[model samples]
Target: MPSIAYILSAIGIAAGITFILRLIPFGIKSILKDNKLIADLAAWIPMGAILILGVYVMAEIDYSSTTTALPYLIAAVVTVLVHSWRKNIALSLLIGTATCVVLANWVF
Candidate 1:
């Protein structure tokens, strides 16, 4: 177990970092507001984040066994198809997660 002094210092460091991060938006709020480049970056960031998450998830799959991999593959397909059809990220993610959960719980 860590000493109280060590724990308190760690917490203080975390708090300080959080305060600095929170202050950054205030410092740049005016520059961020109504900036087309920032707006464009904000729009693309979420989709990019989703794709990166998908890649990481896909990389974790055990490809040697078809049974274990089937649900993940199916979920990926469902996510892509739903996204293409609806063009809604949240809905597609929800449906894909539901599909994966159902398949893992009941089908597999």
Candidate 2:
């Protein structure tokens, strides 16, 4: 085991780091509040997230054959169409999920 002095020194260092880390959020809170950059991030991040999800999902699809691609393709097309018509994220996601599940399990 380590010496008591060594353990105390380590604990002191850890406590100092933790105190600084916890102090930082409050330190920057005023600067971040009502910032235009932060407002833009809140508005655009959702679409960016959705686009990243779409690209990641598309990248995983096996496009080598029709049997593998049809379910995903039909689901994507249905999702896009539903989103276009209704502009409802939850409904589009639900319908797309249902379509993929049914097609993947029952038909394909």
Q: Rate the local accuracy (lDDT) of all candidates.
A: 0.94, 0.93
**What lDDT tens digits, residue by residue, belong to model 2 across residues 49-84?**
988998899889999978888899999999999999
TM-scores of all models? 0.73, 0.69
TM-score, prediction 1:
0.73
Give candidate 1's error at residue 61 in angstroms: 0.2
Clashing pairs in 1: none
- Candidate of highest TM-score: 1
Alpha carbon lDDT of residue 45, candidate 2?
97
The 10-residue segment with the lowest total lDDT in model 2:
64-73
10 residues in a row with least lDDT, candidate 1: 63-72
Please list the residue runs of candidate 2 whose C-alpha ends up more than 4 Å from where it truly belongs after superposition.
1-31
Across 1-108, the per-residue lDDT of candidate 1 in tens digits comes to: 999999999999999999999999899989879999999999999989998999999999999988789999999999999999999989999999999999878998
Q: What is the lDDT of candidate 2?
A: 0.93
